[model samples]
Target: MKLVRYGAPGAERPGVLDAQGRVRDLSMLLAEMGPAQMSPRTLAALATIDVERLPLADAGVRLGCPLGGVGKIVCVGLNYRDHAQEAGMAVPAEPVLFMKAVTALSGPYDDVQIPPGAQKVDWEVELGIVIGTRLKHVKKEDALGHVAGYVLANDVSERAYQTERGGQWDKGKSYDSFAPVGPWLVTADEVGDPHALDLWLDVNGQRMQDGNTRDFIFDVPTVLSYISGFMTLEPGDLVLTGTPAGVGLGQKPQPRFLRAGDEMRLGAAGLGEQCLKCVQS
Candidate 1:
């Protein structure tokens, strides 16, 4: 099922997509899509609703981050061999984990803010995993059972703040609107094989990154189980499984970066696309 949240930024209401790709309001049946509703049982119940009967949303309504009250965003970096090589870094022995503040969460099509004096802004098209149940110290074999769904994400970053700031990558990654999530969350059952999806990103209509999940050095279950060992992952918590090569910093003729007014269009198979504009703060 394709689950969504549409309306103004903070007032978005829960919804589901109908056969024609129209928004069918679920507000009457569900107050909001949050941690509790992400559980397998609740999602199963939601799947039984007759989408054709729900009221359609107003035409062209703004979409908000699909899930409300997101707990935290855990990200894995350098999990792709090509991306690590492009950045001149070694492929890690284990998942290279990082945190993107929940505050960075934004709608899939929202404008990404470029902070003052920031230069070297970049884009990363990645597969985002949404946790459905509490998981702690779970083995890799059982990790898939805790996932609710997946979403496409653009992990907008500022290369300078991330590398030259003399601090953790979170400094450049936690900016507002840096984590534009979904047009909708495609349930686990619908996604089929999480590691076989194709992913791509374009800037101003020019293709910048074109890759596939088949190249992942460490797959989904490994990432989830590895993370759960240290930090408890709860429903509504998001995990960005990292991006493949072709980021701005990896451009051949020096590096290309985002300037105000640049538009980024990106997506993954099964997960819908995202169109975000870069704007100055």
Candidate 2:
């Protein structure tokens, strides 16, 4: 099922796409599409509802980030071997972990604010895993059971603050509107094989990134298990599996970065596409 949250920011209503492909309001059934409704059991129960009977939702309504209670946006750096080569870095022996502040979360179609003093703004198209069950030190085999669903994400970054600055990567990545996620929260069951999908990104109508998940250096199971080893993975916490090659920073001749008025379009196979514009902060 493709679950959605629609309406103005701070006033979104829970909804789901029906077999006919129309948005069916699910607010009557669930308060908000958050941790409470993101569990496997809850998704299973909701799947049984007759979407046709639910009230209709505007097909063109603004979509907010699909899931609620996104505790922390954990990220994997240079997890793609090809991306590592493009960035002139060695393939990591283990999953390199970092965190994006929850404040960075924003709607897929919203305009991203290019914060003041930031120059090396860039985009990364990634597959995001949304946790549904609490996990701690779980094995790779058990990681999938704890995932509620999957979603598309753009891990927007500022290279200057991320690398040149003396501090950590968080300063460059945690700016508000940096984490644009969701056109939908596709259920895990709906996405049987997570690694067999195509993900791509375009800036101002020019394709900058084109890749598939099967090429990931470490698959979803391994990354999740590895992350849970150090910290508890809670319900509604998000984990970006990592992006593929073709980011601006990896470009040759001259590296390109985002500037005001730039438009970005990105998508993952079966998840959905994202359209975000850049504007001055």
Candidate 3:
């Protein structure tokens, strides 16, 4: 089922998209789609709910990030060969891991904030994996068993703070409204082949990123297992697999960075789209 959260920013209520594509309220059944609801058992129980009988939401309610109680936002850098080549870097033998602060999380359609003093804001369209159970030191063959579902994610970045500064990449990545994640949280059972989906991103109606997940140097299972080797993966922890080619930074001659008033729309096959406008902070 395509689970979601709808309504105003902070007051969003749990909901699901019915067969007719209408948003049906699920608040009476679940508190919210959070860490607890992300587990396999919880999802199985939620499946027993009869969406047809649920009350339909009003016509004009806004949509929020599909899940709540998000923990760490871990990201893999340059995991795509083409993206790595465009950035003038070599494809690493292993996944390059980094974390985006949870505060960066925002509703899918919310405006993206171009933080003060940031000049090189850019966009990255990626596939985000949501963990359902605790995992540590798991083998690659078993890594996928720990995932609950997938969602569309925009890994917004400020290149100057990321590379120019002598610190970790998190500095440029963890700004407020940087991670716009979801229109829906599609369960793993529905997304049969995670690596075959197409993903794209547009800035102000111009397509900047267009690629597929098949290009990922490190696939989902590999990435999950690799990270588990070092740290414990918990429920609600998100892993942004990586971005495809065609980012603004890969443009010829000079890079095109995001500016105030710019709009972005990104999505994956079956996962749904996120539309956001960039505004000065």
Report the number of the highest-TM-score candidate: 1
Question: Of the candidates numbered 1 and 3, which has the greater TM-score value?
Answer: 1
Off by over 4 Å in 1: none
Writing each residue's lDDT as its tens digit, candidate 1 over 1-281 gives: 99999999889999999999999999999999999999999999999989999999988999989989999999999989999999999999999999999999999989999999998999999999999999999999999999999999988898999989997999989999999999999999999899999999999999999999999999999999999999999999999999999999999979999999999999898889999999999
Lowest-scoring 10 consecutive residues by lDDT in candidate 3?
59-68
Kindly report the root-mean-square deviation of model 3 from the true structure over all alpha carbons: 0.9
Identify the superior model by TM-score, candidate 1 or candidate 2. Answer: 1
TM values, all candidates: 0.99, 0.98, 0.98
Taking all chains together, the TM-score of candidate 3 against the true structure is 0.98
TM-score sort, best first: 1, 2, 3
lDDT of 2 by residue, 105-218 (tens): 999999999999788999999999999999899999988999999999999999998999978889889899999999999999999999999999999999999999999999
**Which pairs clash inside model 3?**
none
Off by over 4 Å in 2: none
lDDT of each: 0.94, 0.93, 0.91
Error of 1 at 41 (Å): 0.9
User: Once superposed on the true structure, which residue ranges of model 3 sit more than 4 Å away at CA?
Assistant: none
